[model samples]
Target: MRIADIYKGNTPVLSLEVFPPKPGYSLKSVFRTLDGLSDLNPSFVSVTYASQGESTDRTVEIASRVRDEYGCESLAHMTCISHSKEEVASVLDNLEDRGVGNILALRGDIPADFSDDKRDYHFASELIAEIAARNNFCVGAAAYPEGHIESKRISLDLDNLKRKVDAGAEFLITQLFFDNRIFYDFMERARYRKIDVPLVPGIMPILNYKQIKRILMMCEVSIPAKLLNMFDKFSHDPGDLAKAGVDYAIKQVSELVEEGVEGIHLYTMNRVPQVREIVFRSGLREKT
Candidate 1:
């Protein structure tokens, strides 16, 4: 199914994102994770891409399995960094052959040490336009509620987003943010700018302090003061920290639902228990 059609439904959409296992790790382990996630009956599951060699193939493999074996729609992430047009075409052709219908186009992060003078794609909008030319996939792109870390201004970020949408991104999924107000403000600005595709908010439960902190630093997302205090209070207790994190995510999801947000996409981080808890506790499963 086209992921864009999901937002057209009256009911709220719930989705999960899982990354492909890194090099030397067993793909079987991810299948076990998918088994648990599939039971939640998510609207779809997205498999994140890895720009490296074999890991890229694994992205297509996992996404195909999610759709074919798990009986759920699957969205595959495709990045255009350090890749030529031929390489991008090969990946897209493989996905199409596997019957995958959805793709999230990204201008991926370039490695600091790896510099390629000749790259076919520089921006995500260019990738989106290339994908649109095929007329084959439901394309999704990333959005920033707090503006992208590299973007100078939020308005300029939104302008870039408009270019992406105009290039044929059917929908957008946002970067993770702790504050819902930030997302709401972004939505208001997006509407004001007349970029009206379905914008799904991405939520990541704060599973571990170090992990989340590292992620926040990389993405430049601000941690809310209340959440910062909770993290400090639970710093010593792993069990308590996890429970508190799940509680915080549950609260966020509940409020988003009440506000009639179109969809909630959880970054599962390859762990099922916390995501399952948040989904049930937030009453998302009940509503669906």
Candidate 2:
């Protein structure tokens, strides 16, 4: 199923996002992880492309396996860093032949070893345009609720999003955020700017203290003071922290659904147990 179509109908939909194994990791482990999570029967699963300087072929192979072996819809992440136009064309052809029909187009981060001039596509909008000219595939682009790291302001980020939509993005999935208000504000702003594509909210259920810090440092998102307090109180206590983290995520998801958001994408991090717990407590399965 095209995820956009899933959102258009009455069935409440949920999807999973998984990263391909890093280069040199055994494919056996990746398959084991997939087997653990497959019974959830997500609306779809997205396999992230490892960028330049990371394992590349394994990512593609995992995406193909998710669709063919698992019998689930899959979206392959396509990174434009360190890839020439010709290289991108070749990858697209390979994807077509493999029966993969969905992609998340991104202008990935520059490699530590490569100079700026070595990169072909600097902006994701450019990649969106190129993919729009191609054959049958659902093209997705990223949205930032707070703002992108590269953009100076939210207004500028919205303008960048408009360019991608104009280039024919089918739908949008936002960067993971904790606060529901931030995502609601982003949706209102997107409507104000006349960008009408179905916008899916990315939900990350915080599983631990270290992961929270990593998110604050790496992603352009803010942790609300309430959530910060949760971390501050339980950051040192492993058992208590896990309980509080799941509760917080459940509340966040319930409120978002009450507000009529399009859908939710869980960043599973290849951990089936944690993802299953979140879905069970969130009351989403019963409500739908």
Candidate 3:
């Protein structure tokens, strides 16, 4: 199913994201994690594309497995940071041939191994324009609720996002955020900026203290005081920490739904229990 169709469906939707293993690591564990989550009936699952130096062929292979073997719709991440127009087109054609129907276009990181001749495309808008020329799949793009870390300013990022949409992005999945208020503010700003695509709020259930810090370091998201206090109380207990995290995520989703936000995209970390608890407690399964 296309992500746009999922968002346009009647009931509130829940989705998950997963990343394929690095070059040396075995894919057995990764596939196990995805298979475990398959029973949850995710609206769709996303498989991330690696940066330039990494192996993206494996990523696309796994995405195809998720759809063909497990009966789940898959969204393959496509990046432009180090790929040429020809390379990007070839990858898109490969995905379409494999029966994958959705794509999450991105501007991936520039890996240290990049050589002068290897680098080509820069912005995600370039890829979006290329995808628009074909009707093979439903296209999705990333949005930063608090603003992209690389952006000079949020206003500039919004303008860039509008261009991506105008080029033919069907929907947007935001970078993960803990605070719903920031996402709400982003939605209003996007409206002012005339970005009218359906925006799905990315929600991450912080399962560990170290994980939270890693994400903050990587993405430049802010941690609210209330959530910090929860972490302070349960940081030592892995079990308690997980409980607090899921409880907190449930509260976040409840409030976001009350505010009538579009959808909740869970960065499930390939953990089914967290995803299950969030879906169950958010009162969505009952409604569905």
Candidate 4:
């Protein structure tokens, strides 16, 4: 089923995002994570593609397995900035052969090793348009609740987002954010701009203090002052920090669901236990 259709169901959509195992690593671990999460009944499992193509095959394979082996709908991420138009078409063909139908089109970050002038698709909206023209798969796009890093202002970010929607994005999944208020505000702004597709909030549990801090720095995602404080208090204590991360995510997801958000997307980071805990504790799913 298209991920967009899942949101229209009576129950809230519960989804998890996972990445392909890195180059030179065995797939055993990631499959284990899937096994651990199977009982959670994720409405769908999305596999992220590597822009550099190091794990592209693995991404397709994993997404296929998530459907064929795990009995869950799967979404495969496609990064077009680093790929030629032919390359994108080739990938689309491969995904179709694997029976994967949903795609999250994105203009990936430019690699430091490559110059910008050589790419075929310059923006995600362009790629979204291309995929939409195919009419074979359901396409989703990424959104930033606070604002995109490349955009100078939130209004500009929303403008780019509107282009993606107009180009044929069926739904949107936002980047991970700590503040729910910011996401709500962004939702209102996007709706006012006439981009009325379902907006799924992405939530990542703060598993590692340093890693989360570095991500916030790179993505420019705002860190609520209180969350920053909690990180500081637990920075030196790994065990305590993990516990705190779960607790915080439970509360965060609980609040989002309470607000009647159409869907909640969890960034699993390939860790199943904590994600399982968050789903049950957040009341998105039961312990059964």
Candidate 5:
């Protein structure tokens, strides 16, 4: 099913994002994680893409399993970085053949050693244009509520987003955010710009201090002072920190839902227990 269709109804949609195992990891553990998450009854699950050769195969394999074996709709992610036009087409063809109906188009991070002059695709808008030409997939693109790390200004970011939509993105899912106010402000800007597709807010419950710090730094997401203080006070206690993280996510989600946002996507990080707790506590399970 197209993720955009899932948002057509009045009931709020709840989704999960899971990544394929890295190069040397076993697929067994990832399948196990999917098995555990299936019980939460996500509106759909999105499988992230990997640029590595073997892991790329696993990306489609697991996404097909999510729909075929687990009886859930799947959105397969495809990134254009470090790929030729033919390579991107082949991946899309594979996804269509496997019965996966949705895609999240991305211009993934470029390695420090890679040069842009040698790249076939540089921006996500270019990739979205290629996908649009195929006219066979429901496409989703990423949005940054707090301007993207690489972007100089949020206005520029929204302008780029408009280009993606014009190129044929059906819907959008935002990067993980800690503050609801930021998301609300982003929506206003997006609407004013006339980029009016369903914008689903992405949420990631911070389970550990070290892990979250690393991710926040990489994504260039600002940590709220309140959340920073919580981490400082409970950094020494893993159990307490985990509980606090779940609570914080629940609070964030609850407010988003109350605001009548179109959908919510959880960056599960392959941790079923934390996601399950947030869904149940935030009353998402009841609505979905």
Candidate 6:
């Protein structure tokens, strides 16, 4: 089913994001993660894309498996940064063959050695239009609540987002943000701009000191003082740190649900136990 349709029929749609294992790993571990999270009743599971050759294939395989193995909808992510228009068309055919109907179109990080002459797509808005032209898959795009790291300002990001929606994105899922206030502010600006698709908030649970540091570097998200203090006190204690991270997520999810969020998209990091705890403790499943 189209993810947009799912949103139409369901309230507070619960979703999870899991990536395909890197180049030389088995799918066994990811399946196990799904095994543990099955009972949370996710509206759909999004399989992240990798631009490399075989890794991209695994994205299709894993997304189809979600439906076949678990009887749930799947949202397959497709990155356009490294792909030709021809390559993307082939991917669309493959997705249809596998009965996967929803997609999250993205312009992944541009390669350091990227050459303009060979690029078929420069932005996600172009990719969204391509997928929308096919009219076979439901198209979704990403939003950065605090503005994208590459973007100079949030208003500029919002302008770009409006164009993507105009180009054919049916809905949007945001990058992970620790501060709900940031997301809340973004939502207000989005509505003011008249971009009226379902705006789902993406939440990433901070699991360890290393992970937190890496997220800061990669996403450029601002860390709230409460979280900074939590990390300061618990970074040395893995067990306590995990507990605190999960607790923080529970609070975030609970408050967003109370505020009538259209959905909660959890970046699972392929860790089921943490995600399961967050969903239950936050009362997401209970409300469903």
Query: Which candidate has the highest TM-score of all?
Result: 4
- How accurate locally is residue 102 in candidate 5, as Cα lDDT from 0 to 100? 89
Tell how far residue 2 is off in model 5, in angstroms.
1.4
Report the lDDT tens digits of candidate 6 across residue range 88-204. Answer: 889989999999999999999877787889888889999999889988889999999999889998899999999999999999999999989988999999999999999999999
Q: Which residues of candidate 4, in runs, are more than 4 Å off?
A: none
Query: 96-174 in candidate 5: lDDT tens per residue?
Result: 8998888899998777788778789989999999888887889989999999899999999999999999998989999
Distance from true location, Cα of 218 in model 1, Å = 0.6
Candidate 3 lDDT at 92 equals 81
Instruction: Compute each candidate's TM-score over C-alphas.
Output: 0.97, 0.93, 0.92, 0.98, 0.97, 0.97
Q: Measured by TM-score, how close is model 6 to the native structure?
A: 0.97
lDDT of 3: 0.84
Q: Where is the poorest 10-residue window by lDDT in model 4? A: 3-12
How would you encode candidate 3's per-residue C-alpha lDDT over 105-129 as one tens digit per residue?
8888666676666556778998888
Model 1 quality (TM-score) = 0.97
Regions more than 4 Å wrong, model 2: 112-114, 286-288
Lowest lDDT sum, 10 consecutive residues, model 6, at 50-59
Clashing pairs in 1: none
Give the Å error, residue 17, model 4.
0.5
Tens-digit lDDT track for model 1 on 1-288? 899999898657998999988888889989999988787999999999975445779999999999889999999999998678999999999999999989999998876776667877888999999999999999999999999999999999999999999999999999999999999999999989999999989999998988988899889998889998998899889889999999999999999999999999999999988988999999988524
Angstrom error at residue 238, model 6: 1.3
- The lDDT for every candidate, in the order shown, is 0.92, 0.81, 0.84, 0.91, 0.89, 0.91
lDDT of 4 by residue, 1-288 (tens): 988888789657998999878799998888999999998989999999998877888999999999999999999999987888888889999999999999999998878788867779889999999989988899999999988888899999999999999999999999999989999999999999999899999999999888887888879998889888888899999889989999999999999999989999999999988998999999999886
Residue 263 of model 5 has an lDDT of 92
